[model samples]
Target chain A: MTRRIRVLIAKVGMDGHDRGAKVIARALRDAGMEVIYSGLFQSPESTARMAVQEDVDLVGVSILSGAHMTLLPPIRQELDRLGGGEILLVAGGTIPPDDAAALKAQGVAEVFTPGHSLEAIVRWIEAQVAAARGQAAW
Target chain B: MQPDREPRPGTAAARPADPGAEVEAARRAYEEALARYREALAQSPEREGLFTTLSGLPVEPLYTPSQPDPDYLAKLGFPGEYPFTRGIHATMYRGRLWTIRQFAGFGTASETNARFKYLLEQGQTGLSVAFDMPTLLGYDSDHPRSLGEVGREGVAIDSLEDMETLFEGIPLDQVSTSMTINGPAAILWAMYLVTAEKQGVSLARLRGTIQNDILKEYMAQKEWIFPPEPSVKLVVDTIEFGSQHVPQWNPISISGYHIREAGSTAVQELAFTLANGFHYVEACLQRGLAIDQFAPRLSFFFNSHLDFFEEIAKFRAARRIWARAMRERYGAQDPRSWRLRFHTQTAGCSLTAQQPEVNLIRTAYQALAAVLGGTQSLHTNALDEVYCLPTEHAATLAVRTQQVLAYEIGVVNSADPLGGSYLVEALTDQLEAEAEKYFRQIEALGGVIAGIESGFFQKEIAEAAYRYQREVEAGRRIVVGVNAFRQEEDRPPEIFRIRPEVEADQIARLRRLRARRDQGAVTGALAQLRQAARGGANLMPYLMEAARCYATVGEIADTLREVYGEYQERAVI
Candidate 1:
């Protein structure tokens, strides 16, 4: 049997505001992806470790704290250190467009800011999966 | 029909000279329509209370002599009187403004302590401690499960050493501290108390609060480490201990903030929070504590959401309902017990990452609503919260938001500025009625614990949350940068980042602590904690001993997990 696209939906750092994060997690689960939620305040190392251990296709870091500048890079770095460069890295939160570009440069595949609907996020993930499978890239 | 005519400014634009005349004409027309409706209703048997408002309160199309009784004084009592729907204090903010509490913590105790001092210097009147997740869960910085978690959520605290460092130069007796911890509240409180004692401050002199609300934990936060029964038992122990020892400290802050943030409506927040408060009151009563003893120290924490009018009405209804229940139902004589004081945090859920700067505007509006609604203390979330832990600069702005409201706005000059406004009062009355209905339903459900067990509260909250989400998704509701007024070209400027080395450093610290601490004492403490967990002994004292001996949170959690097992929630919504 083909393995499901395991996704780790984790809230990084001290941000306890999880309503959006929960909504996204549920949407992903409903989409039939196996999601392992690393509950709030996960460090980048733990996030990377969990992504590797769970053998997830993607690691999605959700942060609402302004600390994303200081927070997201470490996860990207850790993923590289763990030699999981092929595993897609994604982030969502209050990140600005410019910061999103910077994050993409740091190994993040995409940045989902506020106003990006669940459909958009799910579609993006689907596209990423297809691209990885040598289909048309989004 | 007629050619358009533009009137001169001096002469009424188009015969607009009759100001009072126009008013009279409009009034007469409305009265005639009202009389016609009344006559029609009189002839129709089914049209009994057509003039009544939707909230079931009697109203009239017009307030005339024939409109029936208008006993204003009877319904709208003076501020600070029975059924305090208007305001709690006589002077309210006129005499003394609400405390500008900055909720902040990051990295290590020393780092947070510096931030605390900085905030205090910048005019923060009170300290609201936001502990790291491991600390919040009662795990030490060095625990295995605590890896990559230290100082990330808030400040990492291990044993009395961390607590002492957290409040090193800060005088506990002088500055009131509100620690936002729940599951491990008793242990944390013990640590706080022991720290205060070491600071030469007597327990009786210490004044502050612990967000030791575990019922809400099960309903919303999911930070709970124990089952409902053991958690409530621990909370009761804190209440008992506080009532006897820390006379000035509030043992539990019945929190509706998290519930509202969790997607509950205003009525659900009001009803469920009051239900949880009553549960605590009942537990204290069961422990043989006087209704007034623990009740007076009981405080509330609420969320000031974006719906300005609804948020204000919720606050007004909350005070009235709490006051009435404490006086009439609980049979409390103390005025202190009758007062329902609360701390309000501007809705973090309301802030959007999409026009991140717009969050400052959202926060300002929510902060204004909280002040108008009469909060005792307030924490304004930073605009950058949706990104990472708020930068010091961002947190300063958050505090400044409160200061601007307190001083610059002159809004604190009077009490309940919206008290007599028709819309505000009507909304407050409506909220009160709706909340009362839920209270009755909860009563039928055998109160809070039963409601919680049956998943009734969670179902209600989840449904409301989902419904609200649907509204936002469907554009029925407007979130400035989210569902509407969206700018595709905009992007955030900067985001906070955490270094991987921080986690590596934290792991190293844990390893060193383990190597340095007495292996025998650590083993002995874990054994005693496990034994205490198995038995009916109050876990606070035992946890305190464990904390003192450097037993990490994971060790304590492991011990309790052995006894209680992990909680696997059954989805209800």
Candidate 2:
């Protein structure tokens, strides 16, 4: 019996457009993953804590209020502080290319924009989880 | 001539003696033609198995009289008549062009004031204020939650002092203003009224619109502070108060613009917006206010998206549906109450950051659709809006885009120019039916508030958004710059950037105001506000008093928050 991948999707800060986050969560669930969705207006602290408690394999944050620069770092830091550093962090929304690169440099594994596909996101998450499991075995 | 015996005008001179025989021959010919088409399709099949509009409405290859043809007079009356499908006014743009109201706000109050004056000088007909996230969420600039966000997206109005500065030197009576704020809309509106009073403009003389529609906040924008029940009650209070005192002011603009911006399809935007409007009407009726007295002041805001025909159909359907519901369902007597006046904004969601200049063309077409659909006002999204707040040059270009359409283009000479088109009429009927289906489903869930509590609206919108994204990803739908017609080397446009000092200055000003104001009067007014909130009394007058005493937005919102606890939204997924 193999383990099912667990993912946590969250919306950080005052950005209330959660259509992307919700859609991603549903697609992950349909792909046979266990998904926990943190509803709108969640703080970084709460999101990080929720990820640790849920013991998810990945944490996805969506921000469209142009607060990605101010909001993403705190979530990354909280995840590290809570000992969930291994949980792959992915960000997506109306993020500029420059800021996406900066966010990636600051420990975000991936940054998806408006036209990014759900299938691509699911594939990336699966590959990362499998690679992590292989490393643990080694 | 006898009707049955006279030959049809366009029929052949020599034809079959029997009508049935002629029909049989025509059917045979059509079958042969369909077989030939199939053979052709086998060599080059259609692009996709099915075709649909932006709202996911299935499209047929062709439409004819046999397909869902509605009665002309009943479904679409003349302009300014009942069930105003053509338009609300007899002379829509011919009499006077739609108001060119560009929504502009950024940085501190003084900075935003400069932008407002600049826009007005450039021929912007009216003012539309976009408050910062802090103000939208009912927080003061000095609050911990407001750090780094104080004047980022829009103007920061923490207190009446800031509001006063925001409108300084602009006479309130001369220009109408539309504020885009919810959650703490009553508080901000009070500040505006107070500012106008200080400007020596009587409440009766001031004309503007306050986007106090709280239902859409919970449904889409998600800036809700209080729970649904109390939040709706607050909106009703403003409507009742404005109807009695400020007759010229629109207390609420039932907004579908944000709903569409949140990735809902056109039909969802229409159904959800109209459902919310009906809910407001019902709530006001329960409050014992006459329908006609307050209904005339209600307005709507919609998004004109990339799908030209679909967007036009949505607007026409919206007017007809609202007019019918106002008269038949709610029994409104006044013609003004039956009119569904609305402002249209080109879809911000449709703008792409890549090849940002292409967005100019997108906006011009969307604005054309709005004009053709007979909008009362319009705001074209700036080309660089997808990147950041628009630069001064970009915003000016956005206004010029509207000017070209209003003056250079010949579209303004006619009202509802697309009304008689076969496709437009069919789509209008189709959208009206789809909206009616949603209205039934919402009614089944008890009402809009109950449906929201059950997470119905969120789930539907999410599903639609996901489907659209999947289509774009799979190359089923082509977005010019992003998925198709890719460009290799490009130079990113210079976008506007809000200065960091704007937040600091705003905070310092708020702190100073807190120190120097009559603290005793502030305390007294706040206590009264709290009392009014806790009781069954209308809280608008108390809010006005608090504003007069210079109570900060956060203070008044927090006072009400104490009475009605903050809302916590459940995850729909």
Q: Which parts of model 1 are misplaced by more than 4 Å?
A: A1-18, A25-109, A125-138, B1-76, B444-446, B488-491, B497-501, B504-535, B548-551, B571-573
RMSD of 1: 13.0
Superposition error at B76 for model 1 (Å): 4.5
TM-score of each: 0.78, 0.88
Least accurate 10 contiguous residues by lDDT in model 1 chain B? B1-10
Candidate 2: misplaced stretches above 4 Å?
B1-70
TM-score of 1: 0.78
Query: Against the true structure, what is every candidate's RMSD?
Result: 13.0, 11.0
Candidate number achieving the greatest DockQ relative to the actual structure? 2
- For candidate 1, lDDT tens digit of each residue in B1-573? 222223322223423357777455445544554465456434433322233434656543222223322223223334565566766766567546799887888777777888899999999999989887777776666555555566776777666666888899999988999999997787778778878878989999998899999999778876777778778887998888788888898899999999988888988888889989988888879878899888889999999998999999999989988987898789999978988999999988788767788899999999999999989999999988866778778888898888888766556755677877778878887887788789889999988878777878877876687678768877899888787887874554455554445555655666677788887887898798788878867676787677767666567667777887655445442
